[model samples]
Target: MESDLRIAGTNSRPDIVAWAASEDGKVVPWVVIEIKSGASSSKPEFVLPQVAQYASTLGTADNYVVMGTKWFKADRSFRRLEPVSGPTPPPFGSHGEVDDPAVVEPLLTNWLASLTREMAPRELPVGLPTLEGFSVTNEAYWRAAMRAIADTTSRSGFAQHSSSPLIAALVARLIGNRLEGLVLDPFSGVGSFLWAVADRVRGAMERGESPPNVRLLGVELEERTAAIARAIGEIAGVPTDIVAGDAFRVELPMSSAIVTAPPVGMRLPQPYELLNGRVTTDMDLAAVDLSLRHLEEGGRAVILLPRSFVYRSSGDAYREYLANEFRVGALIGTPRGAVPGTSFAGVVLVIDKGDAPGETFVGQAADDDWQVQLGVEGALTKAAVDHLDGFSEIWS
Candidate 1:
């Protein structure tokens, strides 16, 4: 503990530094915790941006800051945040934090600064493809690492970040029982949607039921991230194939269901035919188009996109075409800040390729806690799924 660190070009000492052993037996600092007076402006809760920098400098997996009874934490990230994003402080008593100051508090008072806590330490998770014997399939660790990467990399109000498993769960449900044949994620960032699908199928299996036999395919632009996603699937006993390439350029199959949260707000430089024989510069619209293009006749697509996509002027023609030729099953709104790196509201858009647009299910989120809107038992999601379940009766 009390290790010297070169944070912000200043020589600072952390109150406690937990160390862990790597696969090759290299001991490294695994966590950093700082104790600050609650009355001080520099309390741990107010300096997340700085703590993120600390984690980056010390190469720690998780960083903690304690002020009296309140605790704040930040995960590790190699990238640095830019100006304009400003620092959004973490809340006291964040859910699922991996630190306790009580142990350290006693040590601090007794001046036992060099002592390690009695609890067994977890192996160092040095990120994708680097840390041996570390698994990213653990949702808690996976979520922290993903959030670390997203927070440091995205510096604007409109940036594309990986969707949380919670958001993935919301989108995965719209795929319904279409698990037969190919299940695809065209813009799978770290494969949250794919994992959620696997979780759903596994849940059914646990209940001694047979879900549709399916193949999971994810197309990701980043190779390293894709590799991690693949690893997660392999470790979870779900054989997912993640392609390290662009979904738009890759050869795709006729998919039974497409579940994804594509990068938000990227515009095509030139008009692209991402839709059925149609061209548009809006990538959001184009992504949906590409999904629909590869979607089989009876397939469904569940996509999470910016709420503006629903009413954007550029999507007018595409929406019109969908209304006439395809089924727009549901549009459920998510509250602002539901997804990190994005500061605006999001819409869960569902498309059924084989059916005509019937009485569509439209629902708005009630709060920032997305579960209220998109959980398995989410009120809006339940209502919409129920509508999709019986919408065919409209024509009967």
Candidate 2:
């Protein structure tokens, strides 16, 4: 038995991880135990997901969630649990330690450990016990933890509309290394944009250069997602504020930058509805309109839009309006599978609230290394600087 055993591939650590030899002399973690106390000790739901997650992470099927004496025990599958028969010493007392590396590897294929992920709270929680307990000392750990949360959210079908990390990173590159003041992600699903921005800004900060002090902000529609975002933002070590509400209805601050992958097919409600002369409301257009309206003077916004948003002829007025009224810097087309949970190819619309109307910089990123295509000074960047940026124009 080991206390505070760190789980591989993640930052999660479980208490009382006990190991033993299986029937065929294979070393295995026989049982993972989690102990709870205080007022929350009685609530099984609070600890269920955590234990399950730990077990899944360790690849173990047996778990013991103990409040007092043998409170709950999980079956081999860990899909169901029942009250233990009697009070007894935890599995550690009976199991012999497994130290052989050869045997250890196979046992780890299916193991369990203590868990920290709690059930999603019914109300919007300001902080999470597990999140606070996690010691994320560096950017790499923060990134991994957030990615783990993304996997969990995606596995649960919660953040299906969230942007992929690649797209999010590309959007962050557009934000560049000079981030400051307020930054907003209207859609903010699982805080994909905010995380990407934080990562970029933190990298800059590490270099002692730009992004003096950026305040990452977001408005997420789901309570669970917003809750997770707040935790992730805190863990990211960036000054972040995430609110749970509809992005359209919530009063948002005028931001220096806005990055988002807005909903694709949701119908716009009421006076905010914008069709841009099309038969139906254009969600991307509405998102752009809302972002531009919320932007401070000279503020920049990076938005992800579907191919149709840039190609459809009915949106000519809106496109002209963008070209005429705002500084439409670039319209960079991304590789296929840019949008999560869909095969939709998309484009990154870089706009600024500056009072300038000119040709938009445009390009198509390769299947990978899109950041270099969009950022570094190269042929692609040079071409974009001139009036010859035409990746989207030619394709459309």
Candidate 3:
């Protein structure tokens, strides 16, 4: 139940701060836990440095770092760090391991639970209304739940879907700092894009810097989905307006930056005005066109579209329109199944409204390592920018 414990008299917040009770009923710090997400660096060598730093601050040699199913001890004797897999008890060599099996099991369980809660909030903040009455308050959990719902709904061929969290974060980083005024996600789905924006702002604040001035606007056609998006925005403490309506028909202000993964292969009831009333069936084009219409001059858009939208013969007009009207900044190809439970390989298209580029940068992501590829420090580096393709154009 020490999930909410904070390090006393210090700004540093370790992932989990375990405590043990003494004979006099005085509580004492037992272990410092640092949990890394699956997307993060799980290798002991990569994480132990930071764990060592935290241990130094806590003045405890009983420090541990948990990454996915792996755990490592941070101490002078920290050598040959190997991750212990499965839900079973920690091995004997684990840092701060207790002698009794009964005593250690509950401690490890509580620590894991604490890690989960830290990563995703356990309880929903009071007074927020949700579409589904489910009480799970974790952002990552809800995103997966929404994706599963989309999979079931996709059976009817009504919804396409949003990007996975990894993809969404990558798209947001590609749009980095260019986001100004209102940020729009026309097909918000479960608000992955919006949450990415909030996470960026939150990350900046956490680093003791001023958060960028940006507002989020998400339009989801389904009311239930919109409610979930709204709840996510609230939980993340981001100012967002989630509208339940068709994005094509919804009246919205022009945005400085737009980021979204619009549903593909869906037919719209009516063609968007931005498409000049010529194309109505292709939702992908409609999405691109809608983003173009709402995006202000000098503003930018980072959109996720099916790879066919770029090279397929049927999408020639869309490609031509994109080339003529917008400057192609970068096109990043993602591996198949990056979205999970789907075979739709995708491309991240960075479009600028002012001038069309003579040459566009194109690259394919080798894997879904967003933590390093999209990390605040890691993603913004010159080499990372160049690796993203179109670094010269984007920075120039």
lDDT of each: 0.65, 0.65, 0.62
The all-Cα superposition gives candidate 3 an RMSD in Å to the true structure of 12.6
**What is residue 193's positional error in candidate 3, in angstroms?**
1.0
Ten residues in sequence with the least summed lDDT for candidate 3:
93-102
Which lDDT tens digits does candidate 1 get at residues 1-396?
A: 465344667666567766554444444556677667746734344566666666776676667766665565554342322222222332321222223222123322222111111231333221233223322234433344334333333333213425755677777776765567788999886677787787777667666777667679999886655755665566444567888898878998889899988787687777897445667778888888889989999889999989998898868788888888898988888888787676889888889998867867888887765666677776676677678774221110
Q: Candidate 3 clash total?
A: 0
Ten contiguous residues with the weakest lDDT in model 1? 108-117
Model 3 lDDT tens row, 1-396: 233334566565677765444333333445677778765654556776666666666555467777766666654755545454422332332233122222223332333233223243535332332223122324433343333333333232223444565666677777754766789999988677777777777667667877768899999986655765675566565678889998877797899999998886576776554454465567887788889889998888889888888887766876876777668877877767666446877888888887645567776656666335534344433343454343523311
TM-score of each: 0.62, 0.62, 0.59
Model 2 misplacement above 4 A: 1-141, 149-156, 271-280, 366-396
